[model samples]
Each structure stands twice: as structure tokens, then as C-alpha cells.
Target: MTSPLLVGFLASFALIAAIGAQNAFVLRQGIRREHVLVVVSVCAVSDLLLITAGIAGIGAVITAHPQMVTVAKIGGAGFLFIYGALAARRAMKPSTLAPAQNGSARLISVVLTCLTMTFLNPHVYLDTVVLLGTLANQHADSRWLFGIGAVTASVVWFFSLGFGARCLSGLFAAPMTWRILDGLIAVTMIGLGISLVVS
Candidate 1:
């Protein structure tokens, strides 16, 4: 028989491992080696709070208020579209494609972007609150332990994605590589934004 903790860990990891706007942003920052700790911390802590809220039954509250999700979808879509356009522009400019030449974003800007990427996406709510919470509650008396397991998965994934990206510095040394990355990011952000609006 599967333990609640293991179930939670596996479930949470599977949900977040997908490439999304949040993950794309984290990957870029990790490649740049800029504000990686801040980005990782924000994502992990946000997951911690969200997973806790889910286990505490806030998922039910959110379910009762469908408008909240709608609002997030619209706002997140707009944000992603703009970010995607910027990334596309960057990808087109070879001068801006080099990691060393690409200037670092201000600390405040990184924090805000990270927060926006985390909280503005309705999918985050659906995954962490609705899905994870529902999964945790299925374990009955062991629900909190399930939640702890989920939170651990989140912490581990974000840190690994954020820091592990640094090892790719050698690969990203080429401006062409950065172009390909930014181009992919642009496509991903725009594609996700469009999906959010229609879905």
C-alpha cells in the first residue's frame, strides 16, 4: 500500500515538473545566475503557503468563488503576453543574447516578477490548492503528513531547477544558445497565455 506522504510527493512533483510560465522564468534567472536564491525562495515559500492553505480547506473557498480564477486568468494572460513579446525581441537581437552582456534585472523587479509569475497564474491555484488539497484530504487523518510531503517535493524541485541550471553555463556560453532559449521562452509564454484565455 502507498503511504500518504509518498503519494503527496509524487503527485506534487508530477504537477510542477511541467514547463510553464513560472518554470520558464525560473530557468532564465537560473541561467543568468541572477537573483536565483530570491526566485527559488519565493517560489518554494509560496508553494508552502499554498499547500498549507489547500490542506486547511481554502481550496473549498476558492471553488465557491469562480470569479477569482477568472480574474487571475485574464491578468496572468496579459502579463505573459507582454513578457513573451519582450523575450521575442531579445531573441531577435544578437547583441542582447549573450548572458554576460545581458544586464541583470533589478532586485525589486526580480522579486515582483517572481511573485507575479507565482500568484497570477490560475493554474497554480488549481494545482496546489484544488488538486493537491483534494489529494491530501483523501488520506483522511494523515492529510497533514501528505501536505508535508507535497511541500517537500515543491522545495526540492524549485531548488534543483533554479540552482541546477547553473551547470549549463558552459552550454549557454554561446549567444546562439541564448537566442534559442529566449525564443523557446517566448513561444512558451505566448502559448500558455493563449491557452489560459481560451481554456
Candidate 2:
């Protein structure tokens, strides 16, 4: 039998795995190996809070207020489009291939950027609060367990993405690697932005 915990873990992992603004920023920070602990902590905690809210019926509240979703969509779409353009610009630049270790942005700047990316993105709310929350409600008996599982997934993913990314240092040593990554990020962000606006 498929346990609610397992269902939550798998479902959350699947949705979270999608390449979005948060993931991109996380990946970048992971690659740069700067303030990773802080970054990962923020993401995991943010997800936990959002997931808890979802399980607690915030999803329904959100559904009842379509205006909130609309605001999120507009804000998210705008942020995503701008982020994508920045990625696209980076992809065009040849200097991106160089080691960014010393060039890492200030901790405060990075954290604020991370916060903006996390809070401003509406999909996070929809996915964690609405979709996952609704799915957990289906299990009624073990909804909290399901939330725990989802929370676990977030913890594992962020930590792994942040720490394990160092393993890719060799592969990403080349400039082409950065180009490819930024290119994909750019395309993904733009596509998501357009989707939000149109949908």
C-alpha cells in the first residue's frame, strides 16, 4: 500500500525537482559554495512553513481568494521574466566561465536575493500550500505525517543540492558548462513566466 508519507515525499520531490527560480538560485549558490547553509536553511524552513500552512487548510483560504493568486501570478511572472533576462545576459557573457569564488556577492545581498526569490514566487504557494495541502487532505488520517514527509524531502533536496554540488566542480570548470546551465535557467524562467501570465 502506498503510504501517505511516501506519497507526500514523492509528490513533493517531483514538484520541487522542477527547475525554477528557487532551484536555479540554489544551484548557483551551491556551485559557488557561498552561504550554502543559510540558503538551504531558508529554503527548507520556508517549505516547511508553507507545507504546514497547506495542511492546516490555508489552501482552501487561498482558493477562496482568487485575488491573492492573481497578485502572486503577476508578481511571480514579472520576477521570473527579469530573472530570465539576467540569466540570458550572463549566458552571453564569456567571463562567466571563470571561478566565481572570490566574486561571490555579499552575504546580505545573497540572503536578500534569496528571500526575494522565495517570497515573490507565487508557484511556491500554489504548489506547497494548495496542491500538496489538497493532496494531504485526501489522507485525512495522516496528513501531518504526509507533511512531515514532504518537509523531509525539502530538507534532503536543499542540503544535497547545496553540498553535493561541489562534486560537480570538475565538470563545471569549463565555461561551456556555465553557458549551458545559464541557458537552461534562462529558458526555464522565461517559459515559466510566460505560463504564469497567460494562465
My TM-score estimates for the predictions, one after another, are: 0.97, 0.90
Give each model's clash number: 0, 0
Itemize residue pairs with steric clashes in candidate 1. Answer: none
Model 1, 20: alpha-carbon shift in Å?
0.3
1-199 in candidate 1: lDDT tens per residue?
Answer: 7988999999999999999999999998998899999999999999999999999999999999989999999999999999999899999998887657867779999999999998999999999999999999999999998998899999899999999999998899998999999999999999999999999
Number of clashes in model 1? 0
Please give the range of 10 consecutive residues that has the lowest summed lDDT in model 2.
Answer: 96-105
Candidate 2 wrongly placed segments (more than 4 Å) = none
The sequence of per-residue lDDT tens digits that candidate 2 reaches over residues 1-199 is 7998999999999988887889888988888778899999999999999999999999999999989988988988898898899889888896754456237668898888788788778888889899999999999989999999999999999899988887887788888888898899899889989999889
